[model samples]
Target: MKAILYLPLCMVLMSLNLAGQYAIDAAGSYVKNGAYSAAYSVGEVSTLTVRGVHSTYVSTSGVIQPDPLSITGTKNPGIATIRIYPNPVNDFLRLETDRTDLIQYVIYSMQGSFLAQGTVRGMSVQLDYLTPGMYLIKFSLVDFHESQSFLISKL
Candidate 1:
């Protein structure tokens, strides 16, 4: 009957719509056992390369599907971990560190210009009055360095 045929067609269309909004699990997407375990949503006309923990995965959505490459012996050796919160920061940026011996932090513009530099203690720093732009924040200890790039939008 017409009703039975339409039901299957309608279900197929609904499934396609849901697939477009799929979100991959962030924690489970980590590299597993020296293999590429993450699923990235890439564009049909662009190429993407994900590099992490001494390994690299390259993919071209509409082209060739290649295996991820493993680069051994490039693991991060420093313990000076840095975390930034309120990612899409508005007026303030908070920083936390696992190492208490942090000596200082340096904020830089995307073009490598020094924006601000200062000492921090107790694992937190508040940044204010920053214009809308992208920045590279570097957390430093005696011989360890971890840099993260972030964006700030004032709206």
Candidate 2:
């Protein structure tokens, strides 16, 4: 009789021990299956599952709600090779790329207003007149486009 009760108690304890927390970096994603015991990563999408635990879903545009019993992480779906330097620039901004071919770059205000546009062959852009504020920097390949928002402050 006591042995049967002990078995049940042990199972409960084991379940509690399995519960853990996980975070997904991607914007729009979801997790399914027990305590997230299974995991898969393909390109920009990631899927995880744990036995007997709740599933989690994270999306690029969605809120991040992590499961306490299961741990998971995700990478961004769309990432570019372009890089920006002096992120918090005061006067001049530099955008660099590895590609030797012509690249199109655009700068926009946080409000989505176009601030500057030009072509570059050396993989770098120098912005010397833009004011200090939050702005969006967009780099475009032949068909793919990636944009990141950054802040600028005068030193």
Candidate 3:
């Protein structure tokens, strides 16, 4: 019964392009997800560094900054995988993947409505135009596919 209701919504969202336009309200804050969560301000270095290649994170203000907390020791990103942090996304979302292969990602509303979809470019996605709410992001890799939901908070 519930599947019937959500099926159409998912289908419709898939049909729509990955461009969602809505006014974003409130200031962005830090949201840590699990042990691998970090959010830096407009011009601050993040503590989470891996493989000497520190990955930059997107601020709720939609600003991108460096991710190097220190410069003494070097580290390598242990696992070659994809990671999306600050589940409660806003302003901008960072999409990180160790592989350079083509991966398609789609953002959908909790109700299964498609919100955004596109290829990961520079490991980030702009969300300043989306309304605050819960959303699901589905990533399509070459060998497998996965979906994860996130809360888009106005604050």
Candidate 4:
């Protein structure tokens, strides 16, 4: 009985000694918490970059600045002359533009996945097939590089 109990106690002690903790220590820059670990460098350049459909943002140094991505009733240069109505639309969505040369359009989901594409017919496109969600429609000219993207919703 004593031998069996002694062996079991020794196994438990050994197991406790084997409990996990990070083994790698490099220049003493490692930090560890319960089940979490991280290593840090002393001198490293970090930057933040954000890209949008209409603009781009970058931060080289850590400084708080006004949000450059907010939409404040201003128009994007590419789509300044373009307009769409019935934003949260049902059945059909209408397009209004000064230029009648708009020839093609592509529909994309909010996650940037292409869902549909077709030539522009008349002044509207039938969106009755799309499930209710947010989408983006890109319109392009027939013989020009001018293209515009508009965000719309399906209801």
Q: Pick the candidate with the highest TM-score.
A: 4
TM-score of each: 0.41, 0.39, 0.41, 0.47
Off by over 4 Å in 3: 1-80, 142-155
lDDT of each: 0.62, 0.60, 0.61, 0.75
Point out the higher-scoring one by lDDT: 2 or 3.
3
Residue pairs in candidate 4 whose N, alpha carbon or C atoms collide under 3 angstroms = none
The digit string of per-residue lDDT tens for model 3 on 1-155 reads: 99999999999999988876322334345545433345444423333333445666543333433343434665554324668766677676787776776667787777888777887677777777877776777666644444344444532
lDDT of 2 by residue, 25-126 (tens): 444445766435323333434445444557555543223455556346666644555666786776556666555445676777878888888765455566
- lDDT (Cα, 0-100) at 87 in candidate 2: 65
Per-candidate clashes, comma-separated: 0, 21, 4, 0
RMSD per candidate (Å) reads 21.1, 16.3, 35.8, 21.2
Give the candidate order by descending TM-score.
4, 1, 3, 2
lDDT tens digits, residue span 1-155, model 1: 99999999999988884534332322222334554544444345545789989899985553223446667756655655567777666656677666666467778887889888877655555566667767776666755554544454432
Worst 10 contiguous positions by lDDT, candidate 2: 37-46
Q: lDDT by residue for model 4 over 1-155, one digit each (tens)?
A: 99999999998988885655333222336566544455543422555689999999975532222322433475445433668888999989888887767568899999999999998788888999999999999988877787888899999
Error of 4 at 82 (Å): 1.5
